[model samples]
Target: MPVSSENKNGPYKPQPIKKVSTTTVVNPGFFAYTNLTGCQPYYCAEQVHLINNITVTALTIIIRVQKTSAATYHGVANNFWTGYINSNHTDNGSQIIYTFVLDPTQTVVASTTWYVEAQMDLYGTSQVTSADTYTVSVTGGGITNSYSGHF
Candidate 1:
């Protein structure tokens, strides 16, 4: 039997359109403590606020210390000394907001031992006799924040 070309095409049905979504990481909100003083044993203590909606695997904290130009202190480093936060901690994604102190005298507090280390010795040697200033910057979750302090 021979087939005819006419009426050879089959009926077509309309297909539903599918939607596509793209996921991207969002930056978190950061609030720094502007007023910090190193009067307590040559170490300044302050808390930083972070509002995150996504997981932050690695966070970097940088602290830079420098003696003020008007400072007449000796036996201390007059230049900028930088410190970093080198640790393995992951911030889970959530709607909850948390704050942490930059320097803590005790490692464990209320069973939660999370704190940043910005010791005066890390900045320089001896005591900070005269006025000194420090700048701390934190970077994580695609955002960066910074603040200044004095002693």
Candidate 2:
């Protein structure tokens, strides 16, 4: 995805495009960043949008989470830190689960979207003083997508 315009916020703004390459055109609902909500300045959960681009059939999607920064932080499950897909979709806590099963054997169709939320507490001595960068990546259906932000 490329930002094609500018706003008061600055450059690199996310824009909608129908063509990705000379041979390929974007699908009807393959939009990713339309629902993206970027990072907060401090002490807040950050969200990023994930989309399924494969239209052949429903496939299981998994998001691998990673966090790094010059600062340090501590994450305690069910406390200051938590990760989950949005309420409209099903999810599991221990592992990244984009549970789209309407029934036992069914999964969400392609072009469906989900948002992953992650938050943590700055417990280390340098955590509050430095910046923390969180990155998430997902690979499935021969396509890989990733996003990163600071908090």
lDDT of each: 0.28, 0.32
How high is the lDDT of residue 109 in model 1? 15
Tens digits of per-residue lDDT, candidate 1, 1-151, equal 1111121123322221121112322232332222232434334322221222333333433333343222221111111112222322122331111222322221111211122323332233233422333343444455444444433
The digit string of per-residue lDDT tens for model 2 on 33-119 reads 312122334333333344555532222222222234221222211110122222222223322222211222333346554544444
Q: Please state every model's RMSD to the true fold in angstroms.
A: 26.3, 10.0
Give all TM-scores, in the order shown: 0.29, 0.33
Q: Give the residue spans of candidate 2 off by over 4 A.
A: 1-42, 55-108, 122-131, 144-151
**Ten residues in sequence with the least summed lDDT for candidate 2:** 72-81
